[model samples]
Target: MSTSTARFTHLNPGFICENCQREVQPLKVGCRNHCPFCLHSKHVDRFPGDRDNPCQGLMEPIAYEFNGKKGLTLVFKCKECGGMGKNKAAHEDEVQADSYELILKLNKPKS
Candidate 1:
């Protein structure tokens, strides 16, 4: 099938992340499948929900931001397609572990 002439959004979430070895989440909301700490997202959707891409690869944590009492966050940019997106961290993920590590490193009585 030729691309550029086709368009899709809904995620067919059924691929396991080769990077994290975890089941991917559906395009369905509140399904942050990526490991919160790593902030890695699968190259499933091309534009948020617009799933229309040819290069299927692992999207890595490139960057992120914080606005207010929102919450922790990170960004995932596909190295293969140059697609970028931000995702909020969720519990039962690694981000929490990272947060703890960050605090620990900060509080370490300087070796």
Candidate 2:
């Protein structure tokens, strides 16, 4: 689907992380896309919160980027389909924040 035509479904449901097996809570504001503890996500959406993707693969945290306006964003690669995606980090969430250490580890410069 085209970006303009793609549908966005805002569904924020708690789920267990497939990578870390951690019980994750729903986000208080935005959609809870990835696990806050492990920073891993599932390939479950064609668009944001759509939950229409059939890949159902575990997405591995590969890297991160810092934006002045958007703050920290994480990059993920699907283990099954090799598709890549990005998500905004939830480090500032009051209930369950994304791992700052893991975000730093992913953002570190390679020697």
RMSD of each: 8.2, 4.0
- Best-fitting candidate, scored by TM-score: 2
Clashes (candidate 1): 4
Give the C-alpha miss distance for residue 36 in model 1, angstroms.
3.8
Residue-by-residue lDDT tens digits, candidate 2, 5-99: 54555567899999889899999977878998989999997775788999999999999877789777888899999998888889999999998
Clash pairs for candidate 1: 8-51, 9-49, 9-51, 37-95
* Cand. 2 Cα-lDDT: 0.85
TM-score computed on alpha carbons, candidate 1: 0.53
For candidate 1, lDDT tens digit of each residue in 1-111? 333564542333444666767555443344453553344676765455465556666777655454467565556777877877656645334323333343222222222
Q: Model 1: residues >4 Å from true position, as ranges?
A: 1-15, 23-29, 50-52, 92-111
